[model samples]
Target: MRDFRDAKAMAQTLRDALKAKSISVSHSESLELVAKTLGFHDWNVLSAAIQSSQPAAAKSPPALSFNGGTVIPVAPMRDIVFFPQLISPMFVGREKTRRAVESAAANDGRIVVITQRRAEDDDPDFDALYSVGVVADIMNRVELPNGNQKVRVSCGKRVAVVRPAEADFLAAEVVPLEEVRALDTQAFALTSEIFEAYRSSTNTVPPQSLYRYAGEPGVLADVVVQLLEIGVEKMQQALEIRDVVARLETILGWMRAGAPAKAS
Candidate 1:
């Protein structure tokens, strides 16, 4: 009684057996054949099943929920783009920014963080920030002696600002942005290349942390994107890309073109 987790090994064995018989099939073709033999429609279906069956600890965080309303406190980032499932620390010093973090922490621990178009815009209005951002959970908050707050957040879902809200801090009504995940053999291979490249590039991220999302390519792409030492605009470009394969391809391209894969 094999499950989706064993599908990849089965496909590999099938390919080897066929090769021994002088029959040649592309890796993707073999994956498709194994998926069909397993009663799944396509490799994508089997891949999705594999992702869904991952252990709870390995799975990406569930999609964000806002029963109260879509309007949430918006914190404009200066130079970083936060991605879902990546827990990163943030520094809040501005009056409005501190209030926003406080408000979210005091309530549901949920907040919408959008990157500012220009990092120098100390007081950016909602219109001055990027429309696409992430909804994150405020994990921990510590007040500093310099009147700043150091907060940690775990991003959950991609979100787009629908409109501005009149609040103490920058606030926005946003809608969740769905990821377009089209996983295939190519994507899986790209993930492997990324892992290898990342290993050769930096030691900031633990190998186990990145390898944990092998079954979930989209999440793995985001995890890799978060560790890249690219500029804000390039990071934003990665954030806006919904397709998993496209995202993975773009990241690999950046790495190959020497776009600095080290995390800052």
Candidate 2:
């Protein structure tokens, strides 16, 4: 077993590093991994330490930029942590959403798809929303019988939402996030354990499907994280973690704690 004190210290150091860059760590699983890795046996101690060492406020949201005179807001049906390599066809049923899709296809063929923060609320005027979302390009489209539409979109890049715009349809100004180079050590032992557990639980192997989408070893963790039916807050934490090894360990801890069962 790992020493609880050491683990807490390591987690605190990493937490400080993340805070310096305006990134917020929301997932409990990630915090647990940080504790375990540093040799802590109890996660509660680490959590208390983190709460005590909380950093200053996060920086202000950035401004949005437009392309081809069109900007749109979108809500994702599922949490997409890392964009799948293959193009995914989506069905847009809402009036505002369909209009946003159509406008994107008509203008620059691009739209931002952010995970729906409020799944239960039916109201359309919700103000608090996740700022980070992906900007996807339209690949194809078709009309449905019920006045709805189907669209095929390919993930382009990650973006930060500035603010919601008042328009005939839902629109938002966005700026793209910087891409980070993959690090080798992210393929840690915890990743293998999680993969094995996932296979045993589902009676299905993910290597083949993951390879088809992303070939690199470092990208495997991201692909697996995206496939899991976890919450938006957890997915956002995985995206915010810069260290690949730390992210994989965080996911593995969640798996061990029976996250999938709870999610289902």
Best-performing candidate as measured by lDDT: 1
Please give the range of 10 consecutive residues that has the lowest summed lDDT in model 1: 62-71
> Candidate 2 — what's its lDDT?
0.60
Model 2 per-residue lDDT at 72: 69
Local distance difference test values of all predictions, in order: 0.80, 0.60
Tens digits of per-residue lDDT for model 2 on 173-216? 65555433344444545556766867765666755665452435
User: Where does candidate 2 clash, by residue pair?
Assistant: 2-39, 3-39, 3-40, 4-40, 7-38
56-150 in candidate 1: lDDT tens per residue?
68866646554323459989999888888878899999999998988898888899988999999989996588778888999999889997889
Clashing pairs in 1: none
Regions of candidate 1 where Cα sits further than 4 Å from its true position: 1-63, 199-206
